[model samples]
Target chain A: MTAPAPPSVAGARSLVEPVLRDAVARLDPLTARVAGYHLGWSDPYGRPATPGGKALRPALAILSARAAGADVGSCLPAAAAVELVHAFSLLHDDIMDGDRVRRHRPSAWTVFGRSAAMLAGDALLVLAGELLLEQGTRGGVWAARGLAAATQRLIAGQASDLEFEGRPEVSLEECRRMSADKTGSLLACSCSIGAMVAEGPAHLVAALAAFGAQAGLAFQLADDLLGIWGAPEVTGKPVLADLRARKKSLPVVAAITSGTTAGERLAKLLAQPDPLSEPELAEAARLVEEAGGRAWAEAEAEHRLDAAERQLAALDLPRGVREEFGEIIRFIASRDH
Target chain B: MTAPAPPSVAGARSLVEPVLRDAVARLDPLTARVAGYHLGWSDPYGRPATPGGKALRPALAILSARAAGADVGSCLPAAAAVELVHAFSLLHDDIMDGDRVRRHRPSAWTVFGRSAAMLAGDALLVLAGELLLEQGTRGGVWAARGLAAATQRLIAGQASDLEFEGRPEVSLEECRRMSADKTGSLLACSCSIGAMVAEGPAHLVAALAAFGAQAGLAFQLADDLLGIWGAPEVTGKPVLADLRARKKSLPVVAAITSGTTAGERLAKLLAQPDPLSEPELAEAARLVEEAGGRAWAEAEAEHRLDAAERQLAALDLPRGVREEFGEIIRFIASRDH
Candidate 1:
């Protein structure tokens, strides 16, 4: 009757939140106040606690470990670490993007001031390292190295993203590289770290990483679509927001590089110095679809999904648990918000 | 004849630079450009490499390991990590403080954009962790946890620093806590991590940390004095720069809280809405001295230096190496640049 709990929801509710709370509880009171508020765990004045994010990364970590035949309780630190890294990225990204709202509320920078948000993000990053070091017995060093490598790629991706804002001529290949580095690498790290914590065989760990990587790319493509076309009420972002900012998302890059007539018109419309009008924004979306960008992105997402499924098949996990991961990927690729 | 290599300069030159270079070399070109320039490894345009900082933290790490009876080479990774963390803090601090010049060159945030500088600092922080993970066999987990704890305290210190800028009535105890978290913690970590990497006895590691903590406090006191009185050409900072910015440095705090006639006058002059004139700045400095702030700080520095020497003597290190660390502390307390 409840539509069957999401694949990893039970484990997340029981295992992840407690570990996360324990780690965050160790922060100094001031830094903890800012972080807790930003995470939706408390109000601006730090009294009432509320539900935060979906716990997607931590759930993935826990599920991956379970699928690898490990005791889920023993891997809670690794799972919490994955969530901490994700939270760290969000806090900094909100500042970099000048985003005023996140999760339908004022962003941390708006409420806590920019310097506090910055320090809170830095604190989360350091906390991630501390969690891994505390859990260093079960492949902690390996997980720590993977997280560092992924963080390097994440920073590179963000730097490239900022650079792309100044120029609209970003190529499709460059966009793909950015997507892999920004989203795919961290997702892959999440899955691989879970397996590492489980002490799974090498082949299984590699397979899970590959699965997460492909799934991550697909998830990004879906997010790009939502950015441009999803209902503002549901997505919590204004419709055609990406176009208004002239962001060179994947579809935009694909259309510009298509060299078709529609692509040319789209590029010309986007090159103007002024902000876009509503009518012009609508036409731009049409131009992208007509230029085959929409088609190409849709097909690419499907292809990535298939590749992820194949990778999952090779992971040597129980059929039921593998199905759970497969369903999660599907949700990522197809969800409207 | 050659000043006996300053305890660990040979180890720094022979081992630390190569490791540091290799780590920075691995960053993506865009991120690497900003970081390399910030480190004084290259010009802003990525030209020939130049010399960088004094390598003080890394050298201290190596010297600590040597005093712990380990081969210096075994601890090079830890040494390089210390330098990386130091550089990370400097890059971020320059941005937060709105400082335009560093080491007589434009700061990284001014040369590149703020975002690039921020990413470069994040990159360096991540690299510090990666380097530790790579060298994880010899006390890798221990060193990683120590660095993470130190970074958390550092962030807390910076957050407190920013908070203090808004309220000028900070207490002396609050200032001391900030100084310990900001300066003493990382310096202490530099010594402890080196000992950890060397797998030194616990007593030796704890003693080195205590010595470094005391010395770090003394170093900050010396820096505060330089900020107020050292010549611009020698200190690379304008005269009374801290006073001009109304910074709550140790001496300034002491003066304001001294409850004397001169202290009352200094407070009234600083509370003005307008910036202080050059003569007002000079008068403020004289008022602080007249209130006994300068004498108090000098005595405190001497007391800390002596305590550091006693801690070093307790380490059971060979007399030569112990004296070398003592001499380094003396230099830190006396250096103008």
Candidate 2:
């Protein structure tokens, strides 16, 4: 790939802020406060912070469009729309999975309670639809359709995620299937939709979609790796948190299939009711590696990354623009945390 | 006073079924099946049922439009929309309220599990939004606004409802406020949106909204009456289900306020731990009557109907149309079960 364009990180931040700002202003104080808390605009005590999350999904939509030859101004609505969907899912997922901490603070549900959390999530989701309907793009129809489809996939993926509880029979393929639906589907929505809004050539847009899809899979694989092996400081949670929760992440699924002693031990250890001690977490992580799960997951992540690279290479994006998104995809896959 | 027109129950039934049928068909087979079950489309085993919910909401919507002098043909989208919202609320309510039966069968969550139930509800709500968005009427925006507002109220009302458990001091006024948000708001949506789709004059539409709002309050009062004393053969649930559940419905609230012997007994029974037997249920019902709770509730229902009737009388609706809806409101208010 040609030398990377200057990162759209700053451009996207500038572009997306006001859309959200206007949205916040339009809300009544209570819902606005609830929503503000969700955007990490406030602490559990309702105090403001430095703001939060990388705004990755929205950035991807905006960056990909410029990379694919569209103006950033026109893609703002799609960017905001994707961010709302992402936030909505995060809120509900936190509630259902009983995840108490988010961004090193109490999760929205844990603070506001499940009922309010669920309603807040609904409000965000509906806001996405409203954003799409209010879009300036000629493809507002398609934008609405894409956002809705992504929503369905997100829920379906979450359904599978919940189904994976305590069920050791999860196949790697199944994890991949769930990941694609949950993560990759929305990422694909961003890329495909970004290009569509840019009026990027159809074939190029398809390639961008493929790139986003693979990149999303790679991103998730990397996240699973972090969950299992990355340092607690880097990952913002305990090591082997997925194993403790009995989440059927890629590493865990791969380990089960290997049937090594550590793998067998992991399956048995997870069934116990005692809370996972530090040793248990370390032991689980070691078992996954000894069973070749870590290597396998790494290889899978790389393979997806390679596919994303190939799609990018196929696309005739401007050198600077292409390099910017390429760096983003690589960062998503290769970040230590 | 002008004579009320008799509702063509059969005609309304025929008009709404096909609309619901086609709209629900909007989902994929898997999700649609879940939705169909939620709508009383199938047995738990996925087998089809002969028919479904009374389509009462949709019928009211279409009839309200006709009563307001709009072509019924044009209101189909909003009609399907409000019904879907109703169905969405029901699906979620069953899960939250722990109700196991719907329309004489196992609730969708009991049959399909909570996640599927949630998906089904979400699908219906999303489809409702899509239908409203694509409807292309001058009233389309109004329908969307009313629906979004009503749904928010409905959800808030449910939140208030679940909050009432173990709170011994819930007064009659609070119960009325909660029921208005829960039921009255939606009924107002049905008729208001119907008139909106027909582009009826604002004053007349407001009048119809007033009528529907009152009707819904009266309807829910009748429901509270049936909840305690109505027979299972007619009411479709075991008698006194609400009493056993310790539901703080209107009569209980009224009794507490009336401060009679029966009211005192009700207060004591409500504070107890054990299940109320049939005799106990009868005693509680008797106490509510003795304390004038029943009469008060009945009078309240009549007062609402009178308000509804006054609103209808002010509307220059075709005499036949106005009378038909008036009969519906009366039937709703005074139903035996």
Candidate 3:
């Protein structure tokens, strides 16, 4: 049976953004400015910023709290804390990945200078803990602990990702573990923190985290698809941007290990120090598909999405809350950009 | 009055290093390896590391807790947390400053690669919070909050320092403010967290933080002195390394704005885009001293130390605690490295 239309993402974000903005505001003036600009609360010139970013992590956090039977009001801090952490990672990830653009604008490091952006990211991470400290309930300590653990794993994942980038010997297994740590850990935190804030039963909390982990894997696979095939206008990044950097994205790694002629060609092209030309980059993308990387990623995404769906039955969520979460999972799995 | 031959710093460090090591061990294996190397807990080849840093921050934390009448054993986590934050900053600061050497060894970023070092720093910052969360008392939450606040200020301080580095117009006031935030805030946190963990009275805690702030300023001023005048063998850095970078340290900034002929000469020497030659760098250092920068820094340091001393009467510390702490303060003010 078809599920009813899910709750509005915009609605969920609007509910969570104020709290998130308030937390960001608590930074020292200089950091607040950098974080504000990064969060799209202001432009580089200090004028009010136009709305930007999907507010997806906070939406998940709020939805997770609802699924665990909490009202929006009580769960706001958990949602905001997770969003702050998401922004923190984004700031550092841009620096670590050396990407110059994000969300159709110059990335924070490119505009504010790398050191300032890094410091801003550092401030946001601490701010997340500070905001969580104010929660003052028993769950506050547990929630903060969970966030800390997730952040550590996220850092570990990114470290592994960087380590793999310089090595051609990375296996598919290693790549998947990196993806799970880098992406899944924080998403799981978003869920786990929500449940902790709601005082959800331990089993329910574990189930929600499991759902988030699988959903995150699906999200990364979808992201891998977009990195290759999506339009720049939609993705807000140049087409083949990841390939231009010779990033060992999942599909690319899959193709490299496929033991086929096209795979060998892709591997050789990636080893050069010079920037890949447009035609060469395009051909590289095609070779990945032909090497069965695209098909493998698609199947994996579906498999993860299905696995995520099964975890929902383990939660005693209300009907509407369950439907809304299902819609988000579907969105993550199938989004084009 | 002469501070009665301050307690041995090595003695203090020996008390705190094990706790710090235990916390460092909590990181995931890969990050632990990177952090271990940075901390001198392990070699690059994963062999046992030689004795590393001086454990200064943790010593201060533990001493502050003692100054608040808490036993060293009970305050270990708070001390460890401060040390973690200190290491976190060092890791990121190395990246931001682009320095290749730290503690007389290749910096983590240079040896492990920048992204890995950055991720390791991120992991350390989160680990600081996690260790504090395990404090498990009411003071645990407040102590974590204190650490978070200090961390945010430190980031702001670093951000401003980065901004000042690229501009020629930094005022002594701005430089001093940056020093307070970057250095003083964390020192203050060491004291404040110690007191909070002991559940010290609010006024006493504030007084300790105030003392730490003044002492921190003195510490930075002493550091500035060493940056220019300390022997390479003692400081573990090349002679005139700060001058080579044309850093806007208090002395350097004071020299530039001193309105003397020497100050003008130093400014012109600094304005060149190319690196200064050995003769030019030495001349610049002499010019700074000639412009009265050294004297000003020395006097400022004494003034700050005196101010820090006055805050101690407010503490009502145990009999030996105040004397031991006074010795530590003296040590911070006068140490060559």
Candidate 3 colliding pairs? none
Computed on C-alpha atoms, the DockQ of candidate 3 is 0.73
Query: What TM-score does model 1 score on chain A?
Result: 0.95
* Candidate 2 residue lDDT tens string, B1-337: 1222234654666776677778777665556777887777676667888765665677678877887677888888888889889988888788767788776777888877766677677777777876775765547656765677777677667766767774878988889988998899899888778888777788877777788899999998988988887777666677787787888888778987786777887899778788777788778878888889888888999899989888888767775777777766776666652
Q: What TM-score does structure 2 among the candidates reach?
A: 0.80
DockQ of predicted model 1: 0.72
What digit string (tens of lDDT, one per residue) describes model 3 on residues A180-284?
998999988886677788787888778888988999999889888888887888678899988987778899889989999999988998888788899999999
Ten contiguous residues minimizing lDDT sum, candidate 1 chain B: B1-10
Model 1 residue B135 CA deviation (Å) reads 1.3
Q: CA shift at B253, candidate 1, in angstroms?
A: 1.2
Sorted on DockQ, best first, the list reads 3, 1, 2
TM-score of chain A of each: 0.95, 0.92, 0.95
Best by DockQ: 3
lDDT of 1 at B256: 86
Clashing pairs in 2: A5-A320, B5-B323
lDDT of 1 by residue, B109-151 (tens): 9999877888888889999988887875747667877888888
lDDT at B307 for candidate 2? 90
Ranking by lDDT: 3, 1, 2
